[model samples]
Each structure stands twice: as structure tokens, then as C-alpha cells.
Target: MSTTAPRQATTPTSTGWSLGDIAVRRVDEIELPRQTGPWLLPDATKEVLDEASWLRPDFADADVPRLASHGFAVTAGGLRIVVDTGIGNGKTRANPAWHGLDTDFLARLAAAGFPPESVDLVITTHLHTDHVGWNTRLAGEDWVPTFSDARYLTSRTEWDHWAAADLDEARRQMFRDSVHPVRDAGQYDRVDVPEQGREVAPGVFLVPAPGHTPGQVAVELRGSDRRALITGDSIHHPVQLSHPHVHSCVDLDPAQAVRTRARLLDTLADTDTLLLGTHFPRPTAGTVRRENGRYRLLAEHGSEIAATAA
Candidate 1:
């Protein structure tokens, strides 16, 4: 048995893994406040989390599941892609933790060798506030596309759903600042993602993963030797692997979310596919294993950059 202790949290740096020809890095934004777990995943009570002993200290701090907001920068087939931009710096968000903050996200991205200007594509797994916040940044008086040279890609179904929904003031503000700017600049490209999935770039495909939102899709990366799936919000934490039915508080369709998660886990279990979670904390990437008829992650640690002064 491997007796490896969970990796401790350190200052955000250029941490990543290499999948044959594909190189992926986790660019740190900010670790969410401790309150996020209970609020976002109310069903994952302390008792439930305690059951997954492996989750302690790393993925979860005792009973509270630990989560961080970050982006995965991928270099594949000569394309520099960013998967799900985290909450951007200086944004007015309804959630207090996400509102009007400052972080060195861009600098971290550059450290990972993915500067904004050099980014070829921005893959938005869904149109949620957090996922798209970095889609644009405040430029003088107006929000502008952060990745000036990149094309923003998201599922056509995701864009259409938000287009028709009666959004709250905060959500509208998110769209106005983060989403619309990219579209207005002709940088947003909506792709039709069928049930089987759609390839947006070489070795990069968008797999249908709905229910958290109407058209949430998981990004799939296939390398010469390994395949990895980026779970947008479908699997918020490793605890969910132990409790597949545990649903998010904001899931648009909780039942469908469960179905989606179950199917995804079933397919991933005992397979070599690496699961890179969008919100997972340190040691963010892992492999899914069947445990007692449920699932659990066997974390895959990658190379890390030394923590620098903030």
C-alpha cells in the first residue's frame, strides 16, 4: 500500500503534469473561503465527508471539503489553451468571497508559459459566473477580452440557455462584464456539442456533461499515451466520488446531475484516464478507482514551482 500523505497547500505556482505529447498546468487564482464547501455542496455533510478517509487533510480538511479556483493551461498540438478561467481580479460578484478581489492570476499563467496574449483558445466548460469571469478584464472604463488573440469556445447549448433565461442582477452583471465583451469583440465561438462529443482542437474534445447547467460540457484531452477529463463542475470534489448522488445546491437539474456523474465515474473507474478537477485543491489531478462499489481518486502528483512572494 502507498502511504503517501496528502500534499500540503502552498502559494500558487506553475504546477502541472505531462501526458505524452500534451503538457497541462494548473494556474492558481485563489483558494475559496472555507465556507464555500457547505454553501455550494450542502448535501456533503461533515459525516458524509468523514467516511472518505483518504480525502482528509488534502482534498478535505477533516469534514470540510477543500476547493480552489484555478485554470488548467494546456499545450497540445501547438495550441495553447486555457480550461475554465477562474474568478477574475476586481469583479463585483454577489458572492462575498468572489467579490472585488485581487490575485496574480495572469502572472501565474505566464509562469506556466501561457500568457494572455499567447493563449490560442479559452475553453469555457460552462457559462457560470466563476468559470467565465476571466473571459474579460476591466480595461480602463470597459470590460475587454483578456486573451486578445484567442478565440473563446463554449457549447452552443450553454450560450442559448443563458440567452433565454431570466437572469438575476448579479448574473446579468457577470454576462455584461465577462461574457458579452468576448462575444462583442467577435472572439466567442459557440460549437455544437452532441451527445458523443465534439472535437474543438487537435486531441481536444468537449463531452456533454449537463445538469449542473443546461449545457455544461467536460473537456477531454487525449494524448499519445494517456487521456484526461477536465470535470468542469460535474464533480466538484473528491468526496463526490464516494457519494455519487451528492448534488450541488445550485444544480439546475439535480437528478440529471446525478445521472451524469454516475455515467462519467462508471466510464472513468479502473481506467487510465486522468481526472483533472476544475476546483480540486492541491494534487488536483488524479485517477478514478472503484472502491466498495463507489469511486475514489488516487491522486497523481505533478511537478511544482517553488512558492514565491505574493
Candidate 2:
């Protein structure tokens, strides 16, 4: 991996913003693999994890920030509608794969043209550390909201689950660094989707895709005839695109996660939709096409690893 990341993907439009009024910018940060060290696949996940073993070597190096393409939509006048912030610097989660980590997810936000003050809405699909890291920054002795003027929106169920205090050390640590500070600063607002999954923004809505987290959700974006869905940790890798039955090691309810995945896959297959994933490698935005009940990632431009190599 290169020590430096390539520039954020770009396109030209004299309008001076990206993709018309909805400008998306990638924030640099990484969410370490939750599982590391010698670990056998859970009997249930064997087939799913093994299905794409040949591609695992492509992500072996830790030098390049494995950013989940932390990004958001920007208005023509520069108002920021942040989707999710990436892992923060100096967080202390107990999972060995995520321990001993540090990165500048905020600086990248600035580089992407979103000053801390420009953010309007900070939306999170769920309450995982990676989905909410930039929610707060280390300020002197306490963690505080990185965006002073922004409202941090989260699912009501997710907020309640992590704050329950019965979670193990790793989960407790995740909550401490990724969530509590935003609430303490009076910046966090828990939004209830009584229907379980519902729209949270004009063009964005939450789909109750549970099981990964008790309240795991997917954000859907619609504009004119175009539509996109952000599958937050609901499906971790593109490999899962073809094998929706594979369970994420972090899901609160593995069985539920599978059902959500199946539902999502069904939706993708049945509709002409694009997807933006929190962890679907680089250029995370793309279209999904179904072939014999299987799916493949149809990148917006093309594959990155191949272009970078050439």
C-alpha cells in the first residue's frame, strides 16, 4: 500500500459542485477488521467467508487507510449533509483488529472542503464506532462534537442498546469513543422511525435492516429517477453481495442479519438501484446487478485495483 492516498475521485461540471447539487466527498479513515489473529470461521459463516478467499490478499497491508469512503452530500451553496464519519484518532476498542489505531479522519474532511463548521446534518445508519467516529473529536480532556453547528442523527434503538451498560468491554469502549460524547455535548438527537425503517431526510430514508445491530438501518437516497442505498455495515464486503447469508461477526442477532441481507439482496435484484456502502472497498458507490440470484458490484467508473496497477 502507498503511504499516501490518491486524491478523492472527482468529475468536472462548470457548476463547481460534484454531481449537480449533491456533492459527495470521501473522508479518509479506517475501520480495522473486527476479527484478526488465528480464528476459525464460525460454522455458519464458512461458505460465505470462503467464497471470496482469493480476494483477501488484496487488502492485507495496513499502511493505506482502509477508509470506508467516509463521505457526505454537499449542497451547491456548500451546506454539508454528512452521511457517516469514519474512525477517530486514539480510540480504544478491545478488538485486537481495531486496537492500536490512529488516523486523521477529520483532516480529510477538511481536505474534502467540509470545514467543521459547514456541516448541517450528521446522519448515522447505526451506532457502530466506524459509522460515528468523527462525531466527536478529542478536545483537551473530553471528546466533543466535531461539528459545532450540526445535529447528529441516529436510530433510537441503536442509542438505547449501547447505553444499556451490559455490553462487554469492547462494546463499552466503542460506545465511549464513538457515541457518548455527541450526546454529552447536546448534539446527538435520537430519531424514532416508528415504522422501524423510514425516511430521515428529503432524499434519504432508513430501511429497517436489522440483525447486524438490533436497530441496524439502511439509508436510501432518491433524486428524480435516480436512487441509491447506503448499506451500513449491513453487508461488509462485496463478496457478501453474492452470499447474503454470511453473518457479520459483529451482528447483535446473526439470524436477523441474514434475514436483512436476504431482504436487501432481494430489493437490489428486483429494482434498478445503486448502492453506497460504508465498507465496500474504494469507490464504494455503484450499481448492483443480479445474475441467477447472485450479485456483482458494477462500479461507477470501473475497478480501482486494476486502474492503480495499470
Worst 10 residues of 2 by lDDT: 301-310
Q: Model 1 over residues 138-178: C-alpha lDDT tens digits?
A: 88999999999999999999999999999999999999999
Q: Which stretches of model 1 miss by more than 4 angstroms?
A: 1-12, 305-310
Superposition TM-score, candidate 1 onto the true structure: 0.94
Q: Of the candidates shown, which would achieve the greatest TM-score relative to the real structure? A: 1
For candidate 1, the 10 contiguous residues with the lowest summed lDDT are 1-10
* Native-to-model Cα distance after best TM-score fit, residue 267 in candidate 2, in Å: 1.5
TM values, all candidates: 0.94, 0.77
Clashes of each: 0, 1
